[model samples]
Target: MVATVNEFDQTATNPGQRGPAEHQRREQILRAAGEHFRHYGYRKTTVADLAKAIGLSPAYIYKFFVSKQAIGEAVCALCLGERTGALRKIVEETASPVESIRKIYKSLALSGARLFFEDRKMHDIVTASFEERWGNLEAYNHDLIGIIRRVLIRGRELGEFERKTSLEEACRAIQHTMQSFFHPILLEQNLDHLEEDATAVANLVLRSLAP
Candidate 1:
């Protein structure tokens, strides 16, 4: 069976079985795998290669992660977490919901460009996750939409956004509209003028949300 996003999450898959020692070993493997992936790209890095790097056997590695793709998913989760974490911070700290949405667009465009353009090796993992439709990618997208939803809801509450639109519908629509700004492949194509283009898009989206 293919490994699910649950398997990639540190908290969900294992309860009693995942003690500190198990968690440490898993961290070790992930650290080594991340280093190798950053240097050599995910497709070129194998479980055996990770094992050698960390002085563990391939069998031992499998005890933690079921497959190489699982490792890739974990690493990709870390990368995605950084971006979402930034968005969450903006949601909490920004006073204006309208400004929050604007910052979200600019942040995604900037971060996406940095990850996909500067870190080509790590981008390989993201590409694979997208191509394979990994569960973790689905989870990431859900979390992203939830963040957007929070901003939209706050806007409505503060009399900044149209009250007639359905909350869920508005959230999904905004996320879909901004997909190219964050989607790895599509963002890559727009990197040359991403910041400018993203600002224009953000303005358009904000105008649509205005009460």
Candidate 2:
């Protein structure tokens, strides 16, 4: 069974029958670690730094997180939920598969870009963590591809999208083409043109599958 967010939160709060004070302390440390990670890139942020920021000893910090990477994983998990949830909601609500695809792209490009790029340090932390945690990244990519593929398959059944292309191939193409918007390339280019760039990319993919 998939673990719900509440379940995870409960487990974090009550690990091995810990008391309320301990639970609160753990939560406080996690929040401090997140802020440190967001302000300073993962490489620069150390457990000692987090401990100092949170007013805890480095040894006590290790009681909660074994390594800085572990803290980073927790942060990534929380952040990715926002991205996935937004896209999934858009996909489920829209009747037009083409429009759903465009909305997801636009959401990712605009909202996701703002959330990601607003803090340069956080952006670098996420990119580094994503590459280091390849297994997690692969799982996330697979889930996203599966969602898009299902949408395309449904579109074909409804005669909204062309049935000529294989669903898997089409999904792969969309995922691959959309990769640039999430990576470091966006930083190098003038982001003043993001809306046009996002719409152009979305339209290209949508037109390819047009009936």
Candidate 3:
């Protein structure tokens, strides 16, 4: 089942309402948690471990995060939020819809491969998020699909892509086709010749969109 953003957002105070000290404390916790989660793996790390790492008692940690799982969710949200922001920036900078689609696929595959190979330790947290069906995963996908849908609409308006199919269907189908290039769990098995395969898939999707 898909999870909601609230599943992760519930762990922390709303940013707008958070005081200076509260914000600093949360940032400190998240930074320390990220380091521990990357080096020690999320499952092996505990609330007490995090507290000790940051020179705080476990009880103090609990004041900010209710549980270890909540911390994990918050950490996952932070990582996924960075990725989504990067992709959005890519979309904004690229002018052509067709080229934007190509870059998106390339970015997805390259980033996924980086996490799988160079950052396998850090990738564990993301893999757990996928296996456990966390809400942040769905939230990330929703934001990504929205990006693709907007690109598709722009392409159609520019007479660069077919408008026969609805943008919703087109975007969903594109996401389904490109899942292996982006999804962490799925991309692990397709590392060899990843760039070639990603380009081929992107080309195929682009051709299918041709007017």
Q: Could you say which candidate leads in lDDT?
A: 1
TM-score of 2: 0.75
lDDT of 1 at 123: 78
lDDT of 1 by residue, 176-211 (tens): 888888888888788888999889989999999989
Candidate lDDT values, in order = 0.82, 0.69, 0.80
Backbone clashes, each candidate: 0, 0, 0
In model 1, the worst 10-residue window by lDDT is 13-22
Candidate with more favorable, higher TM-score: 1 or 3: 1
Off by over 4 Å in 3: 1-22
Give the lDDT ranking, best first.
1, 3, 2
lDDT of 2 by residue, 1-211 (tens): 1212232223353222122335677678768877887777678888889889988897665555545665666566556656767888888899988888888778777765676568666666667756566233554676678778878987898898998877788899988877756543452353677767878888998899898
TM-score of candidate 3 relative to the true fold: 0.87
- Which residue runs of candidate 2 sit more than 4 Å off their true CA positions? 1-28, 55-64, 130-135, 186-190
Write candidate 3's Cα lDDT for 12-53 as tens digits: 332211223346888899899999988998989988899999
**How well does each candidate superpose onto the true structure, as a TM-score?**
0.89, 0.75, 0.87
